[model samples]
Target chain A: MRLLEALALTITNGSKPVCRNQNFHLQAGEIWGVLGPNGIGKTSLLHTLAGLRKPLSGQITLMDKPLASYDRKQLATQLGIVFQDSQDTFPSTVLETVLMGRHPYLSEWAWESVEDISLCMTALEQVALATLAQRQVNTLSGGERRRLALAILLVQNPSICLLDEPTNHLDLHHQMVLLELIVQKTLRNNGGVVMVLQDVNLVPRFCTHVLLMHNADSWISGPVADVMTTTNLQLLYQHSIRKLVDNGVTLFYPE
Target chain B: MPVFSPAVPVLSGRYFLVLFFVALFAALSFVVALGLGSADISFNDIVAVLTGTSDSLNQQIILQIRLPRVQTGMCVGGMLAMAGCLMQILLRNPLAEPYVLGVSGGAAVFALLAIVSGLSGLWINGSAFAGALLSIFLVFVLSRIGNDWNPLRILLTGVVISAGWSAFISFLLAVSPPDQLHGMLFWLMGDLSYVQSSFWNPIVLAVVLLPSLVYARSMNLLATGDLNAAALGVNVTRLQYFIYFASSLLTATAVMQGGSIGFIGLVVPHLVRILFGSDHRILLPVSVMLGGSLLVIADGLARSLIAPEQLPVGVLTAMLGVPLFLVLLQTILFRQRT
Candidate 1:
């Protein structure tokens, strides 16, 4: 099933259009990685896809319906996005922060039920933040905060997950563990995952497909084996790249 | 995977305990305020007067003067605190208060005009309320000049208008006669000596608080950021407007009742947040209760501190709140370090 489709999409960063006339369909049970160098509009593209930003010129549909047709609450049920960074204007507990995921599912005057709390706790444990449920969010480390954001997205349980730099600030072990967890969870629920990643080597291992944003009005996306080549990556980053195979696993490195 | 249970019970227990203490403090302050006036009525006399068993001058004192004054103090304090809480969330600034948006400045200008015109009682209050409404309208309109309603824009607009009102207030003060100057100064300093018992203040408080409590959860999400709250399923635009109007109404009503009393609105919410967590479900009501009680006590001090020459309650609140908040912060920091 198609979870998200962008037709004739043109995303911009408020001053200049970044990617133009892009077309992509994210299907259920597939994880797509968006790779780009610095200053590229990867975050803007993800924001546009999540309906947080207006596409410069394009159409986005979720579950075969126009994205703009649904109200915020309804859209949240079908899609969730983990921003690059979370803001803490006021102090709140870790559990309280995670419980916000259930906001869309719950009514205006309702409190979180036991099942909701259970789901949040399970998500926290999956993210290795179960012990810090009572700790204040402002006291968390950057990596811990990132895990907390992922936990919130997990608890949201939307069909389409749009993550901007999901592995940002995470150590190598947590990066691998959490990404694997997100992929496994998405596949288990037959959901679609699109995450912008900084690590080039992580794509071949976690993403089933790749969307390489070269520059404004230029891009290529296909299965990882098809689009993730030395030439394509070199062109994407405007640098030299070398591809190597170790024990039948493919990896790319900058030369 | 390991299974874990949420800390709901612990949090709920803390909520109940904090609420219970704040409510008790409010009740105690009410009783103490009624008994500690110039006439010095005893606790038993207050109870007797309340129960309609005492027919002495104490009855008249407690029933006629102190009762209305205490009630007014409670209403104004609760309204201001609730307004301040909403303003902080709306502007996403901890320093935001009921008067930060020029409501009080407009009120001060108009109330001074009324005093300069030799108006008393209801006329001054009516003019102040009108001025507050005018301020609200101006800020709302000016902030949306380019159809932008961001917090920074709204805040800047309010501050500018407030400055304009301040200049007008200075002009009014400069030309007023010496006799009317006393009343004008009292108004600016937030005197509550002449407030009468009316149902409107409580009604307004209930009206504003009900919706605020109902939307408290959304407010928690909103305090993060607009995009964050919207992505979390909160109707950010609708909620923002609701906060804007609701807090303005709260500030307007509070200024009308008590001449734009300060400190309670600004400090009470922070005090409550420091004691309890920032969960609005608990924060809103507790702040109201604590604010009402603190103002009631402050008003009592204002009345009896000089025994006959009553000081402005706002002065007392600021004097009291500054030390209290500082000590509380220091103790909390010390505890954390230990």
Candidate 2:
């Protein structure tokens, strides 16, 4: 089933329509990457697709229903989003923070069951944060905080995951591990994953599909094999590009 | 993964333990406060009066004066603290208190007007409530810039409106008759002596707190960030409205009862957060118990410290809470540094 479908979607910055008449769709077993320069509405487009912001003129359907039709909790059961930046103004333990992902599934005022706690613990373990379950979130390092956010998204266990810059502050080891984890989960469940990424090289390696937004209004999107060629890369990023193909791996460098 | 996991659940056991201990402490504080007033009532007499086995001077003093005063303190303190917690969550601002959003100031303005106009009894309470609701509505409308419930804007509007209310309050006080000045000043400074004997305050506290407690999970999510809460499926806009109106109701009720007891509302939630962590599931109830108990104890000291020349409960709350708050702040800073 198509997990997300956008038709003629035009997202705007205030009254000025930035990305106009854009069409995209994501089905199960596909991992899509969104790439764009800074201030080009990539975050806004991700937000609009996740039903957090309204599209200027478009129709978006999630799970075959209009996006606006699904209520917040109902939509949350199917779609989970990990924000690029999260702040903890108040102190809550890591376990407590991860357990909040179970909120959409639980009834109001209901206590989390043992199963919920176990799921959270398992996600924490997956992110190597089980040892810090009782530690305060504010006390965590930047990479740990990012992993904690990913752990929260994992616990939500949604059918479609939307991540804005899933890796921003992680070391190379954590970056590879986290992306591998996300890909593993999506492939295992035959679920869809859409992420906004700044690392263009990472896209050709990991993404099954790619959407390159150009300045806001124009771009190209298709299977990664077609959309990630040298000419398309130059047009989307507006830079001279050097492509190196070695041992079935492709690398892009600006000249 | 080698950490030894306790058999008890993470949230439930510690929550109940805190609730049980604070409840016990509140009961103990209530009894001690009942015994400390000027009319020398022994513990035995208090017990007898409580058990309904005595009807004399001691029983009269306990039933008529001390009991009513303690009850008022509990309701006012609990509601104020609860309001403060809601405001802190709603604005995502640690320094938010019930009065920080202009609730108490608005209530004070209307209440002072009532006093100056020779109004007493329910008339004062009615207008104070009106003023409170008005301030809440004004802040709500003013802060709704482009359908965005910007926390900073709401905070700024409330603070500015409160400043406006303060000006009006000062103007009222400046022109009042000398005889009415004392009563108006007492009201402004938060005196519980004016609370009439009634069971309504406690009942109202329960009515408001029940709904607020149900939103504990949402409040915890909200404390993280609005985007985080919305992404987690909490209807952030609707929840913000729920918290704002519910907290305004609580603040109006508390201000009507105790004339804006200041320190408990501002400091108790932080103290509770520091001790119990920031989970509202545990923080909310603990704050109520601690806030109520602290105010009752403060009121007791206020009544007895000068021997019939009672001090305003607000003055006592600040005198007591400021030093503890400073110590807690220092400890937090020290922990952060180390």
lDDT of 2 by residue, A1-255 (tens): 899999998889886566888888999999999998888888898899989888878899997899999988888888999999898777777898899999999887788888899999999999999998877788899999999999999989888999999888988888889889988888898799999999888898789999998855576888999889889888877899989999998999999
TM-score of 1: 0.96
Give candidate 1 misplaced runs (Cα > 4 Å). B1-18
Error of 2 at B4 (Å): 17
Scored by Cα lDDT, where does model 2 land?
Answer: 0.86
**Which window of ten consecutive residues has the lowest lDDT sum in model 2 chain A?**
A213-222
Per-residue lDDT over B311-332 for candidate 1, one digit per residue giving the tens place of the 0 to 100 score: 9999999999999999877876
Off by over 4 Å in 2: B1-9, B329-338
Task: Give the whole-model CA lDDT for all candidates, comma-separated.
Answer: 0.88, 0.86
lDDT of 1 at A56: 75
DockQ of 2: 0.59
